[model samples]
Target: MKKILLGFIIMLSTLAYSQNELATSYAEKGRTLVMEKKYQEAVESFDKAIAINPKSALVFHHRGLAKANLKDDSGAILDYNVSIKLDDTDFEVFYNRGVSKYYLKDIESAIKDFDKSISLKSDFANSYLFRGYSYIELQKYSEAVKDLDKGLQLNPKSGSGYINRAIAHIMIGKNKEALDDADKSILYNPDDIRGYNIRGQAKAILEDYKSALEDFTEVINKKPDDAKAFFNRMAVRLNLEDKQGACSDYKMLKNLGEKPNSEMEEYCK
Candidate 1:
């Protein structure tokens, strides 16, 4: 009887080991698919892994990533919540959850998650960067500046970080700081037009009307249908006493189906 009982126990242990191995294989496949950007397929593979091993926190976290990439922020949050419940030790899980919450506009909740993530891993630059973004949404410019500064210090190549910090600086009336950050943003991401637009605004604030007009004109040169550039250039033209150019931009704004500002309409047309 003792021998038979031992054999049965060994059989059960072997079965459990095989099950775990299968689940791990599926989870690895899911991770590979995620890296391939085949998010839907990755989710399906994660589903199989989860069905086999519902206790795996990593699998749940990966599924949450797939869902987040799919733009299912609410669903991703649900998966992240499950992953956290399973094991709350992974800082990445909390950071990703915070990102999903940020996308959903749950700024306060996102900040809490980022705070937790930072507590777990203080050196993570993205946590500070995202926390800065959350603070910006709350219009806490000083707080945003502090967080963004830390993030940029940690990872200086982050173009989005520089641009966001520029916005905060502009809001705080630090036009020179804003201009410097905008320059950094352009240096990091020359293709992004927001940097040029922000630089133009900063120049206008600094009373460099010609330089500002050139920035706006550069944007229009790259993207002819950009109504934002046209509108800004129109204002700068007016500043430069080019009434005909301002009126021309006003017409282009109307052609693009953009609502010209009431004052601009009165001044130009």
Candidate 2:
């Protein structure tokens, strides 16, 4: 009877280990799918892993990432919540949860998660950058600037970071700093058109109409249907005494399916 009981216990232990090994295999397969950008497949593999090992916090976290990449931010948040409940120590889990929340427009909740992430790992640049974005959405420009400043210091080559910082500067009436950031944004992200638009805005605010007009024209040349660039160019032309060009833009607005604004009507007439 003693020998039989000992054999039973060993069998149970071997079965438990086997289950754990199977769960680990599934989890590894999910990670490989994620690296290949096969998010849907990764989620399926993670689902199997979770079924086999429901207590794994890391598996839940990885599943959350797959869901987020699928653009199912709500689903990602659900997974992240479970992961956090299981183990609240991983800084990356909080940061990714914040990102998912931010995408869902839960700005305040996202900031709290970002704060937690920063407290856990202070040197992570993306945490500050995303928190700055949330602050911008909340209209807290000063807080946005402070966060963006830290993020940029941590990663000076981040073009989107510079772009957002420029916007924050513009909101806070720092035109020169905004222009500098816009320039840096362009240098870093040359294929993007946003920097030209923002730079033109700064130049216009500084009353450098000619330079602003050139930037706006460049934008229009790249994106002919861009309403903001077209309108800006029209306004700048008027300031430059090019009445015909301004009137032409006013007429072209109709072709772009846009109604002329009050300013356009007043100036065009």
Candidate 3:
């Protein structure tokens, strides 16, 4: 009986040690997978960590990120809620949860989360950026511009901020300001395809077909597989009465399995 009790204690000690080792290993692996953008795998690793240490708030937060990356916004929100319940001090959790809520179209809840995140960490540029985007979606252009300006002030190198701000400007009928912002965005990140796309859109709106065509051409060069770019270039060609060019772009769009609009059929045919 004594020998059995001793063996049982030894086994318990080994099991405890193994559990600790597994928690550490899983935590590390989860972090690595998150860095690699393999969010599903990261969630699995984080789940193992949480199983080993059920009280770990950080594990919940990590798993929340993985869920969010995989578009499981509801699951992500639940994880974030648990994490916040365990520990409300982590500002990043609120911010990330807000992003998930935004995608879920719970704008009010998302705004509240962003507000809480900003309250916890005032200088968070990304939090401000996302908040600004939410405001834009809610049709609050003035507020959107304010937060976007703050984000740009915090991180001037973020080309996306400029592009987003430009969109807000355009929505508010400040077309010239929008153009200026887009130009600056391109200056900040010359290779940003979105910047070119936005500039092309702005040029199209302005009826600058020549410049718009050039911008669309550049987009096609950057992304040959994009049917939208081909379709857009076709429109510009039609406007310019370049029938052959329009037909060629129309064929390309059709070959890429894109549904050409009636205008495309009328002009190209």
> Which candidate ranks first by TM-score, i.e. highest?
1
lDDT winner between 2 and 3, please give it: 2
For model 3, how does the per-residue alpha-carbon lDDT over 147-181 read when each residue is reduced to its tens digit? 99999999988888998998898888877778878
| C-alpha TM-score for every candidate | 0.95, 0.94, 0.79
Candidate 2 local lDDT, 48-73, one digit each (tens): 99999999999999999999999999
C-alpha RMSD values across all candidates: 1.6, 1.7, 4.2
Better of 1 and 3 by TM-score: 1
Q: What's model 2's TM-score?
A: 0.94
User: Residue by residue across 1-269, what tens digits does model 1's lDDT show?
Assistant: 99999999999999999999999999999999999999999999999999999999999999999999999999999999999999999999999999999999999999999999999999999999999999999999999999999999999999999999999999999999999999999999988888899999999989899999989988888899999999899888888999999999999999999875788778765
Residue pairs clashing, model 3: none
Worst 10 residues of 1 by lDDT: 260-269
